[model samples]
Target: MNYLLRLLTILFLTNLSASANVITLQSTQDSLAKYSIPELIGKAEVTKDSVYLNYLEKKDLSTEELANVLYMHGNILINEGIMDRSRQYFERLDSVAKILKDPFYQFVSKLSIGEVYYRQKNYPASKESFESAHPFVAQFPEGIQRALAKAEYVYFYYLNGQFERYSKELEGIKKELIDLGEQGKVGDEDLDYLEMSKATVSVYLTKAYLMNEDFSKAEEELKYSDKILKERFHNKITTTAVQQKLTKGEFYFFKKDFKMAIPYFQEVNKLGDSENFGDFQYVARVMASIAYFQLADYKQSLSFSEAAMNHPIPIADYIDYEVEAMRYAYLASKELGLSDKAMQYSQKFLEQDEALKDTKRSNFINSILNNMEVSQLENDLIAKTKSNYVLRYSLIGLAILIVILVLFTVYQIRENKHNKEKIREFMHNLEESDKAEKAKQEERRISKANAEINSDTPAQPDDKTVKILDKLEEFESSDLYTDSKMSLSYLASYLGTNTITLSKIINTYKEMNFNDYINGLRIRFIIEKIKNEPKFEQYKISYLAEVSGFSSHSIFSKAFKKSTGVTPSQFLDFLKEDTR
Candidate 1:
């Protein structure tokens, strides 16, 4: 019985190993037979190079098949962060495709080369490669491939900071997609690819808008992309989701909401890891480092910054993020008193910054700068004339009135000179009397302080009064005054004191009644909020009043005027002027 059982186990083990071999063989054959070059390249983006290469080497292939394999290999190397080796594969494929007269493959190879250049921050070379492929890609029939090529061009434009060109190209591609659908050329499968491409393009556009600080438009594009991705690609669209999260994180980062930005960046890193989104993963790490640094979590900031810096993949094209990571790492190390690490990171940061300064001297950036300069000049001219037609007309009429008034002013100046001397004499006499009155007031204030100090029995606070004052200070520090419904009774209960004591303390220390004290705190809080958050200036008077704990706009306006010697609107205007 033992011998029989041993034989059965051996047979089972043998069969299991045989079955695994068969499955592996079948997978290799299926990959070689079933996938197109483009599909294989897409697969290379997510799969391990070893697995892809194992299958790719198993099959005997034709020249075209060899070219496709080479392309996939190059893409795998790129994913593995081996750029020099990847470029060799791409160059070989380009040559093979040209010899084979495969325009599609040729265009794809050129685009790949351009992507390599882009990743290297060689913008001129990247632009040249992309331009060389454009005509070849355009010669293809209107289909998913053509649309994808056009979208790639738009992405290139965006990366180069040609936002106007990116916008125009995106609109043109969108119109072309609509036209394609209207012509009934888009079958169901074609529709799927088209929608995916559109969604991908929208994600890029969202990032572009974010970089330009157009938050509303960025949000619109993100929503649009997410909708299409959900309806079509569903959970499979990990890259788009990662891009959306990164853009959203960037938006909040710019808004100085570091707490909000951190979660989005963390989500992007999580998704990127799970989905093997190599590029976005590094970007998310860098952004998380920045957010953590901004939040003053030096340890967390250093962790993320070091992760980004040590990433095998080159994120050099994202020069800003690269410099920021170095800067954050330097700052975190310096804060932690790691002098050696801090000096190392600081040196790296300075080196990268200097390199970036040189890169920024590129014609592409110069063009952008020149365009911005021209835009500013045009804006200034428009502002000088006033954008509104009515305002322009009013200004012109005011100018004519000013000219007439100037003529009258010259004649009046001679007649008024003698009258002005008489008026000045009377004003000087009033000033002297005012100075004497202020001196008397100052003396009276000193006399009161002296009387209080010299009194035989000076008033002193008892234990209960001291306790109440301490609790009142705590209440004020707690921001309870910002609560619209907070009353003397409510605050007194919160502080474990009677309303009478609370009111007495407030009147004695603050020199104001409960209502006046609360209103004063609320007004001060609102002013600080407005100063810190410029967007608060755009709020309506009622909204501002409500947020500042007022029951009504009228009450708020009256209190604000009394406390500030200016109405709320006037105060807001003053804030705006100060900001300018």
Candidate 2:
């Protein structure tokens, strides 16, 4: 048994003694239960699963019989979208199956644990489970059990991004499933499960091909997948049918045909009793949101992304889906001019993304361990040799580094002094030029106003343009633009115009796009304040950034440089020099 599974067995053994109806570990009762776990799982009566579990718990079961109960419980928990509890049952099943030496349960239990991990965004652990189950692949009898296990193993390759390894495993399982069907090896009892397995494999294969950007191959896989579903399901909207629909939507989604992708995804959203659901509903809603976003339909995109966020499971349980959904929700909200909601979604996105990165970091460490673990002695030897090489090079590199640093520091100090002298002179000239520029601007404003009065017309501007320009002058004179939460839509709405019109007017008269125009105004305002207020010189750039509508120090520095050809630090340096 795997160490994790062994640990799970020890953990759950106390549960067996909790019920009065518990069977002794040494009991010699018949191992087979009246209801088959696999069959019950296929029925997927999620609502009535508690009744089934209650009935099973009351029975006197043997060692292998207990495995069946565990498997059923695991399947139920998984269907209910409770991954952590489902994982415990799977681990227990794997432990019991190992003791009984049952190939089918052993394989399925390990793979089920893997599926839980995959859904939990622990792909590295999922990969380990798949690999650990590999030796049991051929041990299963060539029927529904074997086909399902092999199909799962093959699907993991696609999940783990090992598409190059996918073709061989996929082809092998497809042939096995085909042979089982052609030879009539599958019994009526196993037919439905077998069909579903075949359909699942085909659908995901199509997804893999589409993900690979192999549209021709993807279409070929789709044809095969559709044929299987049409023949086996006949529009029944089974799980496999739902998966096939999602695959088709993904095909068009990846092809950049957002319009064509919409109906397929919408159908999936309404498929069966779709209960705010599992991976299927989550994926469908997320992809539909992305498709709508691609088509610039912000309202529809926000609707779908919001629906995905409202999935039955907590957002943390499905980090990948949460990240994507939160990201798009934020973007859609932003595009629709909902700043408050956008900021909330943005914070959620960051939280989910950080969690995702943490999982990735663990996987990265695991990859390193796998690559280095030839043997303990070899690892020790390699570490010693690597450290020795590092130390030997470090001293020489440190000397050279120190010498370069000293020289660079000296050069920088002198360069700084020279730059300060140049900037001091430039600032002196700049102050004179500012007075001249202000006079010129005032003269132009007076000239234009007087010209308009004399001619009884504004210069080249229509009445509406003139009104907007006047409102803009009033807007500029106020500190309302200093709000860092400002956006084009907000400004447009404030101006009592649409974004398109506001943008065009800004671009035409201001000779800049909306953001640049706002930023330009902010930079100019802050510069005048910094020049006039002696206390502002004592403040930090970060504070200045926040007060001036730039979100951060770096952004403020860049904008100040772009507008004035001098960084905030350089300007401050010249100011302090002038003050002294």
Best by lDDT: 2
Model 1: ten consecutive residues of lowest lDDT: 1-10
Q: Can you write out model 1's per-residue Cα lDDT over 348-387, one digit (the tens) per residue? A: 8667766766433222211221222221222233333353
Poorly placed runs, candidate 2 (over 4 Å): 1-48, 62-65, 179-196, 272-277, 312-319, 358-580
lDDT against true structure, model 2: 0.67
Which sections of candidate 1 miss by over 4 Å?
1-48, 54-59, 316-319, 359-580
For 1-580, candidate 2 gives per-residue lDDT tens digits of: 0211221222222221223223222222334356465333222232324455555656666787678678768765775678899899999889999899987678879878888887787768978987898899799665655655566667666665455567667667777787887899877755655566666667666766664457898888788878877887685645567777877887897777779989998988886245423556667888798788777899999999999888644222222556668777877887898978876786676666566664332222112112112112222333445666898899888779978887998898887777776666656766786687567547656767787679864556665666677678679889889998777667777888755456657877777766667887898788788889988888999999998988768667877777666788888887787789
lDDT of each: 0.65, 0.67
Instruction: For candidate 1, report its TM-score.
Output: 0.54
Residue 121 lDDT in candidate 2 = 76
TM-score of each: 0.54, 0.55
